[model samples]
Target chain A: MTATARRVVVTGLGMTTPLGGDVRSSWEAALAGTSGAASITDSWIDEIELPITFAAQAAVKAVDVLTRQETKRLDPSAQFSVIAAREAWKDAGAPEVDKVRLGSVVGTGIGGIWTLLTAYDTLRQRGARRVLPLTVPMLMANSSTAAVSLEFGAGAGAHTPVSACASGAEAIAYGLEMIRSGRADIVIAGGTEAAIHPLPIASFAAMHAMSTRNEDPQRASRPFDTQRDGFVLGEGAGMLVLEAEEHARARGARIHAELLGAGLSADAHHIAAPEPAGLGVSRAIGDALRDADTTAADVVHLNAHATSTPVGDIAEDHGLRLALGDDLEHIAVSATKSMTGHLLGAAGAVESIFTILALRDRLAPPTINVDDIDPDISVDVVRKDPRPLPAEGQLVGLNNAFGFGGHNSSLVFRSV
Target chain B: MASEQEILSGLAEIVNEETGLPTDSVQADKSFTDDLDIDSLSMMTIVVNAEEKFSVRIPDEDVKNLRTVGDAVAYISQAQG
Candidate 1:
C-alpha cells in the first residue's frame, strides 16, 4: 500500500511440464485431466530404492530442448530454468531494457541435486581432478537466476529466495516488491526444480511423503480424495516476466495478469507439516488479500497447494474455508498437483501459472481423481470439468504454497 | 582434453559461441565488449572452458583483463606462470 510497493503486472509466461512441453499444450492437458506422470525408465532409477517408482517427468527433457554442451554444463534445474526463461523472454518480445534496470529472481526448492550427487560420486571414484570446474556454480541455489541474469545482462540484481515448496511463489513476490520499491523496471521471476533422481526419491519415500500408486501412475496423485496417500514427485520449471504496470503499458506488452498481492506467514507448529488449526495458513491468505487491497469475494478461482497428502489436502481445505468464509463455495478450487505432481519449489510458480491462466481465460481447471470426498468439507472442488468465470468484473486468482519449514505463502493474480 | 593453442582457439570458440563475434574481429588487446562486443555469458563460457582445457583456475581478478586471444594466452601464461 505504501509508495515502496508499486503495482506489479505479469506480462509474459512460460512453462515446461509433464502435461506438455509448451504452455498451450500443458494447459489443455491439465484441464482435460491428462496426467504428466509415468513410470521411471531412466537407468538412474535402478540405483535408488523409492517407494513409488513413478513420477511426473517432464514431457520434454532439458537435453532434448537445449544443446548437448548446454546440458553438460548446466544442471537439470538450470537447464529447465533456461528453457522456461527463454520462452518467457521470447514471449516478452525480447525487450531491450537497460541491463542495470533489469533484474532476475528465480528460486528452486532443491538446487542441482543431480550435480551434487553426481559430482560426489565422481570425487569418490574418478578423483577430484576429473570433476568439472563448473560444478559449484551449476549446483548452487541461485544458478537459475544467475544464468538468466548473465543471459539478459540483468546487472541491477539477481537473487534467489528459497522457502521449500513456497519458493517459486516467494520469488514472484520478491520480484513484485523489487519493482514496487523502484529497484528495477522489469524482472524475470519464477522457480524450477529437478529432484526426481534416486537420492531425492529415496529420501522422500523414506519419509513416507510420496504417493505409492505405482501401477496407475496417472491416477496416483489423487488430491482431495479420501484415499489420497501422498504427492507424486515432479520436475520442471515455470517462469514469468514481471514489469511495472506503467512500463508494460509504455512498451505495449501483452499483459497476462496483474500481480495483485502476496502474503507470507510462518506456522511455527511443525517442520514438515501444516498447523492443524489452520490459523497461520488463514492469516497468509488474509494478508495477501489485504496486500492486494481486495476482499475474499475478489478471488474467483483458487489454486490450492493440495499435494494429495492426507493432512495437506485437508489442512488447505480448512484454511480455505476459514479465509473465504461463506464465499468459499463459489470460488472454484483446483488441486493442480493431482495432475502435474508436486514440483517442490517450482510448485508455486507452476501453479501460479495455472492461476494466471485461469484468470486470463476465465476457466478454472479441475482437480482430478476426486473419487471419494470426505463430504464433510464444504469447499466446492473443481473436478472433471473446468468452470467458467464471471463475465463482468476483474478476475482474481489465488495461489497457495506451504513448505517443509512451516512456511506459508499466498499470491494473488488479477486479470488485467 | 585439448592443447594450449587449441585452448586459445577453444577460448575463441567460447567467444564465438556466446557473443557470435567474428574470428577476424577478435584481437588480443581489444576489450571484450569494447572491441569484440562479447557479453557476460560469453565471458563466463570462456572462463569455464579455460579451466576445463588448461586445468587452471583463472581467478576473477585475472579474468577481468581477458579480452582477446592474446589476453587469454597471456593470462594462461601468467596463471600457468
Candidate 2:
C-alpha cells in the first residue's frame, strides 16, 4: 500500500437480478428467502434439446426499461450495463465530476452471445448483405464497458475484465485501484450478463455445470445442501458508483459502505474446476484481509460463491476454513446464489452489493432451499430467514467470487 | 403488384418497429435521418427488412440514395417492376 493511497467508498448501488429490478427490492427478496429460478420460457427452448430446462431470468426486462433507440444500438448485455449505470449515477445524486476524471469498468463472461449467434444465423439463412452493421460492436466483450463509458462520458479509461464468474468482482477491484492511485475521482464499476440463450445453456449442460432439476426450479439452487446438484444459470447486472472518500464527503453523498480492499489470485490447477484444497482461494482471502488492514476476526458475514455444485461448494468451505481458521465458524455464511442463481459474470458484483447491504443493515440474508445442510460445510450457514448482526460494533464482511480459468477474487467491505 | 401506398405503409411499419417512432409520423416526405433520427445501422435494418418483405434485392450502392420513405417506396416499386 502506498502512503499517498486514497480511500475508496461505495456511494451508489444498482442491480437488476432475478430476485428484483433494483438493489433494495433484490436485497429484500434475498432477506425474505425468495427463489428466482424458473423453467425456460423462450420459444427457442423447444427447438434445442437441453438437459437443463430451467434458469433464473432477470426480474425486469431490459426492453421495458430502455427506449427502443437505446436497445437497438446496444446489445442485451450492454443494455443492462447502461440501465444499471444510469440507476447508479442517479443514486449517487449525479455527482458533478470532470468527464476526464471519471472511469468505467464493467465485466462479462460471454459478451453479446445473442447478437453474435443471431448474426451468424442471419448470414447463413439469408445473406451477407442482411447482416446488421452494428453486429461487431454489439458482439464485442467490451461493449458493456464501452456503453457505460459513453453513458457517463468516462474518459479516464473504460476497462473490461473477462475473468468468467469473477469478472464482476474483479471489475470492482480494478475500480478501487483506479481511485486509490488517483487515476480517477469516480468510477462506474459492475458486471452484466444476458446469456440465457440456447447455446450457452446447452454448453453448460454439456459440461454438467447446471442443475437438471427441471421439475422444481425454485428449489434447484440448493447451495451447501446434501442434495445439491449444480447451479442454475441466471442473467442480470450489478453496478456500484465508487468515489474517493474525500470526494464523496465533499459532495455530501451518502456513503453506503467503505470498500476496504480486494484480493485476487489464480489456481493453476484446471481450466474449469476448482482446486480441491482451495489453496488459491485461501491466498486470495488472506490477501484481501491484509490489503484492507483488517483481521479475520473483523469479518462477521460472508457472501460466499457457493454455486450449489457439489465440488464447488466444498472447495469454498475448505477455502474459508483455511483462510480464517477458527474464525470461520463465527461468520454468518450466506449463499445468495440459493436465490439469485448463478449470475455468471454478474455474480461477484451482485454478491458484493449484497455483502455491503449486509454490513450496513447489520442483517445477513438467508440462503434459501438449504433443506439439509451439507455436513462438509463447517461454517455457520444462515438458512431460511435473515439473521441480525451484532447490535453495537463496527462489522466487516467478505464477498468471494471464483470463476472458470482458475480466477479467484475476494472483496472486503466495512460498515460505514 | 404492390402499390405505392402499400410500400409506404410497409416501410413505415418497419421504421416504427426499429426506431419506436409513431407510424403516422413516418410520412413519405419525412427524411429518415433528419426526421426519424435513423442512423446508419438502423438504415441497414430498414433496407434488409424492406428487401425481404418486398422480395427485391437492394444493392449496397442504392442504400445511399434512400433518404425518405418515398425514396424507398419508389426504389422498391421500380425494382419489383
Alpha-carbon runs more than 4 Å astray in model 2: B28-37, B67-69
lDDT of 1 by residue, A191-232 (tens): 999999888888888788898889999888988888888899
Question: Lowest summed lDDT over 10 consecutive residues: which window, candidate 2 chain A?
Answer: A1-10
Best by lDDT: 2
lDDT of 2 by residue, A1-416 (tens): 55568989999999999999888899999999999999888898888888888899999999999997788879999988888888888999999999999999999999899999999999999889788788999999999999999889999999999999999999999999999998999999999999999899889988998899999999999999999999999989999999999999999999999999999999999999999999999999999999998999889999999999999999999999999999976799999999999999999999999999999999999999999999998889999999998888788999999999999999999988
Task: Please name the candidate that would achieve the greatest TM-score relative to the true structure.
Answer: 2
- lDDT scores of the candidates, listed in order: 0.85, 0.93
DockQ of each: 0.11, 0.56
Q: Give the Å error, residue A45, model 2.
A: 2.2
Clashes of 1: 1
Distance from true position, residue A20, model 1, in Å?
1.6
